[model samples]
Target: MSVAARIAGPDLHETSVAPRSRSRMLALVIALAFAAVGGQLVRLAWQNEDASTIRVSMMSSPANTLARPDIVDRNGRLLATDVQMPSLYADPLLIQDADEAAERLVRLFPQIDVRELRQSLADKSRRFVWVRRGLSPAMAQRVHNLGIPGLLFVDEIRRTYPAGRLGGHILGRVDIDNRGTGGIERYIDEIGASEAAVGARLSARAPVRLSLDLGVMHALDEELAGAMVRYEAAGAAGLVMDVLTGEVVASVSRPGVDPAVYEDALDPSRIDRIAAGTYELGSIMKLVTVAMALEMGRSLDSMVDTAEPLKAGRFTIEDLHPLGRPMSVSEVFIHSSNVGAGQLALSAGAATQKAFLQKLGLWSALKTEVSSGPAPQKPQQIGRIEQITLSFGHGLATTPLQFAAASAALMNGGTRVTPTFMALDGEAPVVRGERVVSARTSALLREVMRRNVTDPAGTGRRADVPGFEVGGKTGTAEMAAKGGYRKKSVLASFIGTFPSSEPRYVTLILLFEPKGQDVTGGEITAGRNAAPTTARIIERIAPLLGVPAKSL
Candidate 1:
């Protein structure tokens, strides 16, 4: 063989073999890498898309939206909260064995009616069915252990009022879908939900802070509850407010609902008597009349004849407990004389009386949107009959909140600050309010009211607090129904303030349909029921409000 030919042939063959070997190695590595990547993608998709991975939420109902944000007392104690709950539901379509699922569920949750559950699940026409709402974690765990495929577990938010029935009327309750229906809940739902509806669920703000103090609320609730027991009263309601700031520090309405379960709260009467109910608050009118007369240039020394009844049309106005003689403006308040208050209203004239009340925010419903009470009548077209009757808190029905706000105005330098449910800022915001009386007149009225409650001989002696310098007026009005005045039923109310010289807080307590008893001296009047309750509340709440005992 020729040497050149042999060298060329060998070199060419070696180069071809090396090219083929390198191509095979590259292809093998590329294939292995592609397989690893594909496996990772599949594993990720399976992990994220598992059947149990889906989370669902039920729609919120309008009625349920009224459920208020959490309500916290001033000290940050939880008065109310929204508890996380697990609910049992069924996809009838998925439930192949309805009878088995229902039986198993009922066996686990004894509270559930097995027969009813079976019937409900058997109704296949209904795609979605609720087994129950508000299940506990333990209950949820048991239900999960059943492991029945078609039965589903859904998470729900239910309102939990830890205070139980305490402050129920004030905090209110929500509907099943977690919307606020009444009380603070209703107020917050109306104002608190827009931002929460976004996807930022974790960013959802906390429940609202109320002007209420939980400690104060607890004390008031206890005192009123005791009164209900002691007086054998049909029901009782009480409230306290910062006169200068319009903050409700404590409120109680007996027969309140348990937010945890409102459906079973059968007695509809447990609704807020202070905000939704109306009353012909009687001598409580004296507070208005006194403020009216003083603003019209009448002095505390101004005298009115109260020895006998005042004849008006067919009506004769007399003090419940007659003074038996002329009464000074101060004496009129102390005696709680209807004759004297009527005279003041008449002398002030309808226009002036109406104007005074309108300024005091009494001519209209109280400005609180949380209210459901009837609006106060505006002097029935502003005339004499209406004015005279309104003077004694008759012929006009106002919610207790209206009476409280007006009384606060009378004591807070005559400036009517619309009552507020929102928490006050660290320092209260200064709002220019309507002036109902001159500063001097308001001062004089405060003095008169003080003497009425604190004076030993005053009609409201029961309302007196030894060192707190209690000042208030009593009202015992006959309850008027469509037929006529309820012969035996009365609305007993006491409206007043404390440290009368420099007023800080205003409070009121009311009793509805209190039965006459020996303990009440057969009077069944506000002086007997509402007055004493108000006194008890002040005695307990004074320290909370930072009200010092009067200096000796």
Candidate 2:
């Protein structure tokens, strides 16, 4: 620079301003520009960032994001959902005196345990602590008015059961932390992926439309509840389904719990009896026994020598009301003859009986995941005794749904449709089956089953619907406990179908441990309780299901 300056002489030096002054000016301008830029950057970030995310937390907890999806009935009526509420929390370190804060919090939240609060505060190592959840707006406002230091309020969501105990078992419940703990909640949480959750338009919307109808569900529950109260039943369960679609229109297990207050339920007996509990279905097995025999070659007119009780190794086969005369296949069903069923099953053989039952979808668990019901217990090795017991529904155990579907197979053109709890798409008859029997055989079986209810002196005369052409079979099974059958404890159930001339829907009703009353005619049979319930349900839902009255 000195050499170049010398070449230009004094002109170059004078033209350029003094170095000290130029340097100071440049430094000042640079500093001012940076300050202005920094201010704008801060303003932009403050305006655009999602403040809701940063409001209370930087490192968030899963509990903070806990929210449930919605639950709706088949008709889109809101059955269960969630609502946001204010929750009180505290920064224990910021609190001046833990004792003072505890005293004040107890005044506001009397339900809060003072000892627990003090203990939580004593652990000052904790940065934040939950004071209370599910706070009402009024209570939240009152707490906030206190203006206590270290106190904080956060918005928390609480589950609300809109229909109360109407569909309690189906909808299930969630824990206090806002996670699905049971029933549909657990179902959704399993399928609710993170992407689905984030892209969802509504806040925690998992609207599940079940096949349940509230009107039908309430009606069924009311009838079962009445029987439970009137007969002093230990418990009861009932189900109504569309025979064609395997769609359960109504299912009830009582005494039911209220989902709104899950903690109040103390009766462990309140567990779902139909879906979760399993039992030897008793004479109901006779339906499968007769179906298997007919499917094989034993005809409706085929006769079984029931003139004498069939003798086995040590156990002899008999009937509830054994006819001391030769009983035809139809008589076997009408009389509910155990000896006849066992002999018929033995003649049909275990392989044929197992194949037909397996075809009817009785060997495996149902596909519907709404309940945790056990699978139908398969016959052990299909022996002579096993075949005999299986024939009359003794050695085998099945869920009520399984029993219903198997019975439906006999009525619904011999097609085995997988039972579901979701509504059917339309009225179109979409069949899924392996053709367990020819349509001709099914039609013949229907005619014989009809005689069990419509004909006078039929055992199921109580299940007759005046103009509906009803047909069905009655089952009264003794409760099998850990050791053996329990005396005086019975599961009274009836399985039936309407328009038997051209069968449409199959219905079943079950009453567990119904008490005997003087009004019960000295008998607490399925006919007295479950059969009448089935009749009433059929009368009410038939019109709704679009089944027309046909001249028989």
Report the C-alpha lDDT of model 1 over 45-152, residue by residue, as the tens digit. 887755343332323321223223557877687887766677788988888898889888878778888888898888878877889887899988888888887787
Per-candidate Cα lDDT values, in order, are 0.77, 0.76
Expressed as tens digits, the lDDT of each residue in 1-552 for candidate 2 is 534645666675455754566577789999999999999999878876677556534443335345566777787788877687777888888888888788888988788899899778766789789999778999988888887888887766677888888778766777776667776666767777211221112254446777788887888788788778767778888777776778777778887878767763445778766666666777767888888877776679989989888888898877667669998999888888888998898887778878877887777776565655678777659888888888877777778888887777788888776677767666676766666677767887798889988767677878777778888888888888889888798988888888888777777777888888876776877777767767777777777667886654
In angstroms, the error of model 1 at 382 is: 5.2
Residue 478, candidate 2: how far off, in angstroms? 0.9
lDDT, candidate 1, equals 0.77
Q: What residue runs in model 1 are displaced by over 4 Å at the alpha carbon?
A: 1-69, 91-97, 107-116, 123-128, 145-149, 193-203, 264-267, 377-384
User: In candidate 2, which residue pairs get closer than 3 Å at backbone N, Cα or C atoms, i.e. clash?
Assistant: none
Residue 449's lDDT in candidate 2 = 82
**Candidate 1 TM-score over all chains jointly:** 0.82
Give per-residue lDDT, candidate 1, residue 218: 82
- Residue 288, model 1, lDDT: 87
Which candidate number maximizes lDDT? Answer: 1
